[model samples]
Target: MSEISNNDDIRTILLPSAPFGIPEVTANDAEGTWGLRRLGVPHPDVYAMADIVSCTVRELECEGTAGPAVGEARGMELLGEVLKNPGKVARANKYKGGAYCGGVYLEVTLRDPTADKLIIPVWGRELKRGSMAYRQVIESAETVKAAFDEMIEGGSRG
Candidate 1:
C-alpha cells in the first residue's frame, strides 16, 4: 500500500494488488477519482476506474436508494466479465451509466484502441465527512479484490 499527497486537500492511496493479476486500485479524496491502474507503465493504463462526488453516498442511502449495494453488485458483475473475457468486453463496450442502479454508475471504455486495454469507470456523488469518500473507495476496491480472491479459491463466480 502507498499514500500519495499532492497538496493539503488531495490524498491518494495506492491499494494492494488484486488477485489473479488484476491491476492495482487507487483512491483520491480530493478529486474523488478512484480505480485500478497497472503501475510501472509508461502511459495512462487504468484497467478499472471509478469516481464519486462529496455527499453522494449519504444522499443516496438517505433517499433509500441502496446506492452502495447496487454499486458493489454491478462492480462485481463487470469485474467477472472482464476476468472471463476482456476482449469480448472491449469489443462490446456496453457497460456504461448507472441510472438504473440508483446513481452508482459504471462505465467500461477502451483506453487504447490499438490495444485490448479497457477501463471501467464508476461514478457516484460522494460522501460528506473528511476521508469518508476515500475510505468508501478503499472499501469498494477491497471488496472487489476479496470477491476475486474468493472466486479463485472456491472456483465460483463472485
Candidate 2:
C-alpha cells in the first residue's frame, strides 16, 4: 500500500475598517439572506432588514434637513423624526466634529441574534456655497429609499 496526502490552500476574506481600531464587517452576505450560519444565513434576518430600514430612514431624514443652499436648516425637522428611535439593535446619531471636521453623521445599527452587530454610516458635509447640497440630499434620500423598497418588495413589482 502507498501513502498519499491531499494538499490544499485555504482562502480567507478580508474586510475594511471604519477607523480608530473599530472592527469591520467582513462577512459575505448571501443574497436575500442575513446573519451567519454554518450551513448558510441564520433565522430572523435582522441584520439585512435593519440595514434596509436604517438606510430608508436616513434618506428620509436627509431630505427633510436639506435646503436650497449650504448651511440652510431645511431638513432639521425631518432629521428629528428619525432620531426618535434608538436602542441596541438600531440607532441614528448626529456626529458633531468627532473627527476630520466632522459635520452631520447619520449612523444606523443592527444587532443579529448571534450577537453580531452591523453599523452603517452616512456622513454628510455642508455643501460649498451655491452648491447642490439640498438637492443632493433630497435626491440621495429618494434614491436610497427607492432601492430599499425595491429590495423588500422584490424589485419594482408594479
The most accurate candidate by TM-score is 2
lDDT per residue (tens digit) for residues 35-93 in model 2: 21212233322334334334333321322232332222248754554465333112122
lDDT of each: 0.37, 0.31
lDDT (Cα, tens digit) per residue for candidate 1, span 1-158 = 33434446433343333332324444434443444565455333322222111111111222323233322346679788778877655434322232222122222333345653233322244333235554665456454434333323332221
Off by over 4 Å in 1: 1-19, 39-142, 145-158
Q: Which residue segments of model 2 deviate by more than 4 Å?
A: 1-30, 34-46, 49-119, 127-131, 155-158
Q: After best superposition, candidate 2 residue 125: deviation in angstroms?
A: 1.4
Total clashes for model 1: 5
In Å, residue 147's CA in model 2 sits off its true spot by: 1.0
